[model samples]
Target chain A: MKTKERSSENKICPLEVAVNSISGKWKVPIVWQINEGKKRPSEFLRGIAKVDRRVLNQQLKEMEQDGILTKVSFNELPPRVEYSLTELGEKLVTILWMLNDWGKLMIPAEED
Target chain B: MKTKERSSENKICPLEVAVNSISGKWKVPIVWQINEGKKRPSEFLRGIAKVDRRVLNQQLKEMEQDGILTKVSFNELPPRVEYSLTELGEKLVTILWMLNDWGKLMIPAEED
Candidate 1:
């Protein structure tokens, strides 16, 4: 058996890298909800069960800047800001679902 | 501000909690590789791009104990060890893919 050498540079497990990338308090849930089709600002605010609007807004902007989300402002009488996952962001939803599913399995259903 | 009270008990962002749960160096990648259909012990060792045999074995065993992977050993001259994702383990793949997708978006392609 020819043993292959592991690369040292990409040493950190990708999930850990993912976790550290969005380590903020609200990004994961925010990303999760956004992927769930809550595109409008108000919808995002209301969709998350426990996050405050202020923190939600803050996290959203940061995500947008981070390229995880794109903020589109439609020009109309009442200015509307629509938040959508970039192609990159959309790709994340599947993973979040897996996480949610795994969490349910790991933790007792009653505790969740 | 109708701030819904955020529970301190589940304070850690779910992703962070997820990260910590499988923080071992090889678990995430191992999980990812396993989720990708590398079920046998030899396949896991060969599939991962860089993991060492010793570390991979150690990590796989740890994950198995953590309820992430299930190992089935068949009675034979050359013991047939088959590994598969437990229900909880299966759920983590989507999240892992999301993390992989996000990594591509966040990190420059050249670096990855």
Candidate 2:
């Protein structure tokens, strides 16, 4: 897939770009699922509750286009497809872990 | 400020919470500005280009409510207000820096 084209006149903000890349509703959860060793679309549907098939497919396709995921298809009788994180995607998992920790802090302590 | 209430039935996902907290359009920019030591609202308005007063105030208010910022108001004739990142907010800055670095990788290499 071709890399997304940015207009020459607009200056790029890495933070904004990073956020935009993962802004889709199921994108983070998809990444989280893949990080946890779930590779197929069926596995993702089972893992992330409330995500419909069409939405999940769209997010997966977008992530692949964004270079965060690599999709491989097996040519057996029943076709099987698997997705894995690229090097860049692995780097993103590190950031996601940090964000998860930060999120823990946002949760208030249980009342006595 | 009182902490936001989460429903008892719903389990919290820290990553989702973190993303929701900063999903507002100018939220990240506001955080970036504050990380740079721009305390007052006027300073944020000036530092972040193209953000109007109303939108800026809303983002600042949301961040403050999310515990990412601490707001201080002075009782001067013309009220003086300042915002600074909390400990949580500081931690978020470290993550933001990492995200910024990752963003750099998304940019295509210069063609010969």
Candidate 3:
């Protein structure tokens, strides 16, 4: 829908749409770690950044749906899966960096 | 929190953080309407975009809390309230536009 129509119908703002695209709870850190060169599912599970398997899988699936990343599975013993970003997904990191900068400036009101 | 520490602690991703900053459900639309020159709260409530007062008020309060918008109230008959972006809030719109562009491309899987 056009922006005008979208607003007219949904009443949920543009910011919410932006939020919905990546609001899977675990999507962000997964994307960040992937960008930082953690390519394998196991690597993502390990490391200092640890997302619960169920949520991680859900976010990974959603990211693939968003076309932000692609998931490729290998037909090997025990099976292996790898997730990587599409060009569009990679482009989002630059914008995300700006958001990160904003977050840093806005002091968290409470310790989370 | 530092991105690394944030990940270690929350396990939610940076993409989620990006989403959280504006995830109030009604925030983006309100911001979009404001940038389109709907400065008055009533005008925002009106227009083709119809947001429920409770959700709008909640989103507005949250935006003010986020430093994305400042709420100016005039203590007069019927009380006048105006919401406008801070310098940082203004800066966020350009990035929001990028998010809008991405949404346009991501065909909604289902009609809402």
Candidate 4:
């Protein structure tokens, strides 16, 4: 019984970890924007309304550290930077698509 | 261009709504417990650590309103109550399973 209980707890951990990893207010939006091919910080600022630079940068850095994003800085006069989804990040996008479909189910409930 | 942008915005809305609905700290854990056949409130409190009665009740009420759960009350000596997943909630479990798989990908990153 103890072993079974521990196994159940272990099963629960990944879902909690997954939710926590993407639980940041701007994290999912940032990932969605990148998946849509908007690569730069400036584009994200424009695409997602009301997210200031500092918070956006913090979320971006966290996602990068989490291996969901790869940040590339180009040496230039203006010092250009771009972010793209890594393999793990791409996998997350596929799951988000499933979530998006599931979310559609709740829209009618939300409207009512 | 404006119409296209509007379409894109609509696409984003459902995922945001979905995230908001389940974003409650104890919501997913509560759902997991129910899905595991632990139906009573007391069972959830014991299974999930650190959740107080008030917060648990609030999350349960919100989920019931959102159509993710159905609450039943039995009239008896002490009034038994139980919660179970609605069809929408079961659908969400399917998506969460996918999310759980995606989360496993990040475990290696998290370990390092």
Error of 1 at A18 (Å): 1.9
User: In every candidate, how many clashes are there?
Assistant: 3, 0, 9, 0
- After the best TM-score superposition of candidate 4, give how far the Cα of residue A101 lies from its true spot, in angstroms: 0.9
Q: Give the Cα error of residue A53 in candidate 1, in Å.
A: 2.9
lDDT of 2 by residue, B32-110 (tens): 9888879999998888889999988888888999999999999998999999999999999999999999998987876
lDDT digits (tens) for residues A12-51 of candidate 1: 4455656555667778767777777778868877766677
Clashing pairs in 2: none
Q: Write the per-residue lDDT of candidate 1 for residues B17-73, one digit (tens) a residue.
A: 565567676677677777777788678778777778888888888888778889999
lDDT of each: 0.72, 0.91, 0.74, 0.90
TM-scores for candidates 1 onward, in order: 0.51, 0.87, 0.76, 0.87
Real contacts recovered, all predictions: 0.41, 0.72, 0.20, 0.66
Tens digits of per-residue lDDT, candidate 4, A54-78, equal 9999999999998999999999989
lDDT of 1: 0.72
lDDT of 4 by residue, B4-74 (tens): 67455655488898898999999999999998999999999999999999999999999999999999999
Residue pairs clashing, model 4: none
Model 2, CA-based lDDT: 0.91
Q: Which stretches of candidate 3 lie over 4 Å from their true place?
A: A1-18, A47-50, A108-112, B1-18, B47-50, B108-112
The 10 consecutive residues of candidate 3 chain A with the worst lDDT sum are: A9-18
**How high is the lDDT of residue A32 in model 4?**
97
For candidate 2, give the lDDT of residue A24: 93
Evaluated on chain A only, model 2 obtains a TM-score of 0.90
Clashing pairs in 3: A13-B29, A14-B28, A14-B29, A15-B28, A28-B13, A28-B14, A28-B15, A29-B13, A29-B14
Off by over 4 Å in 4: A1-12, A109-112, B1-12, B109-112
Better of 2 and 3 by lDDT: 2
Evaluate every candidate with DockQ and list the scores: 0.27, 0.74, 0.28, 0.67
